[model samples]
Target: MPAVGFSPYTLYSREEWARLREDTPLTLTEADIENLSGVTERVSTDEVVDVYLPLSRLLNLYVEASQGLHGITEEFLRKGNGKIPFVIGLAGSVAAGKSTSARVLQALLARWPSHPNVALVPTDGFLFPNAVLEDRGLMTRKGFPESYDLPTLLNFLGDVKSGKARVEAPVYSHVVYDVLQGQTLAVEHPDIVIVEGLNVLQPAILPKDGETIPFVSDFFDFSIYIDAAEALVERWYVERFLRLRQTAFRDPAAYFHRYASLSEVEAREVALSLWRTINLINLHENILPTRQRADLILRKGAGHAVESVALRKL
Candidate 1:
């Protein structure tokens, strides 16, 4: 733990961080970025070049160093030690652009020659089925920690870290707003895995007894937290809701289809109510508290562009 009143991270402005890109080449085209950007996100080419490229370079370095260390340990043991997947945890508030960041990182990280086979796994897939949530009357607390199947999630991560050749993660559908029954996403052997979620950084409760307890973050080789001001996140949430109302909410298959018919004013009110009542509470009580636990923090400005980065010191 970091000392009280002493910051553990070294902060860098966008300009300073961009400079760290150095000789890193921009491998993604505008078309690639457009495809990578989330529905409510606008990932400008400059953002990728200035922000993501540097991050890609840094991560490449970390992956190479971790691989080297593993090889050294294998040599010391005088045995053929198989490679373990490097797992990264990304966390943030609902509308803080974590999905966009995760997608961007997946794309950028895959382009690195050393770790071309990178897997992106979302923790949303581990959420308890809607039927179970309704039965437990946890529908209102859907994104809360209790709503997830923690043991299954831990098992999946444990498998990945233990160098399991193939791992299948459960699937969730935003269109239906539920964990899809009998659906799963396969993650084959990859050099790295990025696990993105609202509460991936959440810490496990310590038992008074000295028994061992595992956490989602325990499997992480690195972790990132996307952060923004509460007001900014609220505005972005409403904006995204308004966009969904005009687009996805219109689909009959969408769980939020009912919201499509709402008037603009009604939609705005509903979005605000949901934000204030649900998301804000989760952010305050759960997400924000885990921000400091991340190895890196990306602080976004008003336009969802990363304005600064805080990297924890070695």
Candidate 2:
């Protein structure tokens, strides 16, 4: 790794990132990037635009590089060999805005000249369905590492890496808070595939005596973690919940319809209570600890703008 003084790695303020964006000649703009990045506040923070643009550019470069490696491998193996998809993993806390980052990076990176057919697969699909968790008496431990289908998730990554044709993964619905029954997503041959979730970078949870299986993070060609202070994330969680209550929950068909009729004070209190009881506990217990393992970390300030980017020395 390059010494800190000379390293290409940067951790810059939102204003500084914005300045960099303005100075750059190769600026690529996304449609409604603000909304796409979940920047609800009315401020010109460059967390998504500045730091993320460069990061997306970097990932695009990696995709192209992987293609070159694939070509070399294909030539070595002769006619029968097929190339596996390049996989990138993204990790972050509940309201750190990594979901928006995943969406932005998916669209932006796909639009890049290097790799046009990038795929974005979220780990939510790999979560045990709410009913399944309830059946197993683990509903309360939902976001903990144990709640995932670890072997299945590992196998999915393995299959993707094995160059399988037309691999399909299950679909999960946030509105229903369950895995959609019988709904699967087909991931065809793509130059790049990004996997995003809270615990993608987490190490394996296995018995000491068992045969060691590669954790999901083992397949990551590149990884990113979106980060913020716990208090900040808590605030965002509450705010997002409030917004959802007024909007999505208002629909009679919505799964959280019970929250829709709540008054502002009641809704706010419930949102805070939920965060304190569930999400915050999960963050402290499972999520925050993985921040150090990320290849890249996008650190945000109090206003939800990414204040700096930290790249682990590879």
TM-score of each: 0.98, 0.88
Q: With candidate 2 superimposed using the best TM-score fit, by how many Å does residue 8's alpha carbon deviate from the native?
A: 13
70-162: candidate 2 lDDT, tens digit per residue: 888788878555666779899988877877778777776877766777888988888998888999998877777888988888888888998
- Clashing residue pairs in candidate 2 are none
Task: Report per-prediction Cα RMSD to one decimal.
Answer: 1.5, 3.8
Write candidate 1's Cα lDDT for 19-125 as tens digits: 99999998888899999988788999999998999999999999999999998998999978588788999999999999899999999999998899899999999
Best by TM-score: 1
